[model samples]
Target chain A: MSFINYSAKEINCKIVYYGPGLCGKTTNLQFIYKKTRPEAKGKMVTLATETERTLFFDFLPIALGDIKGFKVRFHLYTVPGQIFYDASRKLILKGVDGIIFVADSQVDRMDANMESFDNMKLNLDEQGYNLDNIPYVIQYNKRDLPNVVPVAELNKVLNVNGVPEFEAAAFDGTGVFETLKSVVKLVLIELKKGA
Target chain B: MPQSPFVMYDEEFKELTLIIEKLLREANSKCVYLVDKDGQLMSAVGETKDIDATSLASLTAGNIAATGGLAKVIGEKEFSILFHEGERDNIHISVVGQRVILVVIFDKRSSLGLVRLRVKKASEDLTKSIEKLLSRMQAGAAQENILKEITDDDIERLFH
Candidate 1:
């Protein structure tokens, strides 16, 4: 859900990065955090386990300038992509404004990617958010890996709705901003449409 | 969107901030703030400069959500209140109107019992105010055209 605070002259929205474990969801956020100017970003909070895996979620709030004088702030969150964390994933999606599915592009991780995609749908359904209607984008992440699957094949399997998709090597920051910008654009358009 | 629309106009914002200020004073807490379940900090009052309100808001929401999930699996509807005791400071969190959270941060100046008592009363007041605000937003009285002034060009320029 987007919160429009006229008093503060700010528009706040939540965007979740959903994918399987090791899909670079957190890396995408880390890159954005590093690139954003100090005045434009807040403290990036990561709730991770002892092994550095995300335990709950990663949160980063960035100010995307202003739209018609209202400060447009997007809160970026990445749910713990481990399978057993389904409950945590569902909770994160409670009021999501947009989603970026960061699919690990390694060829051998096909099953893990597909499983996470299906799980995302189920969790969205449980939260009464239809995957088709929500503003969504896909990032085929880790594209620099040697054994990555072809983008066409990943799209054929995961992009059933044909949402805007990008190929990214998040660690190197390739296509990271592109993916974030695309999703943010889509979200703003949706808000303009009053959806 | 399954979640109801959220908008805070001047009147509603004033009422909510007033409530927080009163809660902070009554509870003798260092600060009082409100965050939506999504982790967006709505309003805050009292001595907040020493605290990272944004990080606190995000972490608190995540904590509450995790606890709420635990509540569901245990066959409980929801866990209404959560308290954390720190070395010098403590936090008291309560779910308000099922949409927003009321959080109070205190120190040696206040007791847990006093904070809880004041929070209970403040929660009731906040619930009513938030419900009214929600209804107004739903009715399209105050939030009908929040983005009416925003243009495609304005949105496009952000990326450039």
Candidate 2:
């Protein structure tokens, strides 16, 4: 859920990056954290295992400038994509305003992608959120890999809602900002419609 | 939107801040803050200059959510209070009105008993104030849509 603080003239929204393990969800956030101006970003917090796999989640709060004088900030979070962490994933989705489904585009990971996508829908449903109504976009990450599936095929399975989808190589920063911007725009537009 | 977005106005913000500030003083704590269940930092008081309030807020909520999940598995509705002790400092976290998390940070200058007592009183007042604010938001929902006044061009301006 978004938090609108009139006292601070700020609007804070939560956006989660979700996918199967090793889909570059954390990499997307790290790239954004590294590139954002110091003044515009907060410390990136990663709750990860000793080997650096996300244990609970990764959080990065970034200010996306002002809209009609109210400073707009987006708190980007990535859930632990490993399947056994479904409980943790549900907790992270408790009050999400938007979502970015980071799908690994590898041909061999198709089943993993489908399974994660279904898991996301189930989690959101349990929390009273319907995937169709929420503001969300899909990111086909790891596009640099040679064994990746075609965007058209990935969309056929993951983008049933026909939400905006981006082909991204998050480690190299390709389409990272574009994906973020698209989702943010969709979130704002949804907010306006709600208002 | 199954759940309404959380909104804070100037009046309620001031009231909440005052209550937190009073709790900070009464508990002899180093910091006190309120975070929504979603991890948005609502208001904070005390030695926050060196602290990363945003990260703290996010983690605190995560802690509560994880605990709450555990509660459900064991067939409990929720765990209303959580406390953590460190070598030099401690944290006392409680849920207020089932929506907000009240956090108190302290050190040797304070005792958990005192912090808990003060937090008990403060939580009551905070819960009442939060109920009022939620109602106000519902009433004001029809007043004006801020984003409606903004144009697509205005949104495009943010990126540039």
Best by lDDT: 2
lDDT per residue for candidate 1 within A1-195, as digits (tens), equals: 888888898998899999999999999999999999999999999989999999999999999998777899999999999999898999999889999999999988999999999999999999999998899999999989898999899999999999999999999999999999999998888887773
Error of 1 at B42 (Å): 1.3
How many clashes in each structure?
Answer: 1, 1
Q: Candidate 2: list runs displaced more than 4 Å.
A: none
Model 2 vs. true fold: TM: 0.98
| Per-residue accuracy of model 2 over B83-140 as CA lDDT, tens digit each | 9999999999999998899999999999999999999999999999999988998886
**Candidate 1 - CAPRI tier?**
medium
Q: Model 1: how far is A107 from its true place, Å?
A: 0.8
RMSD of 2: 1.1
Which candidate should be chosen as best, given DockQ against the real structure?
2
Model 2, span A85-121: residue lDDT tens: 9999999998898999999999999999999999999
Q: Provide i-RMS per model in Å.
A: 1.7, 1.4
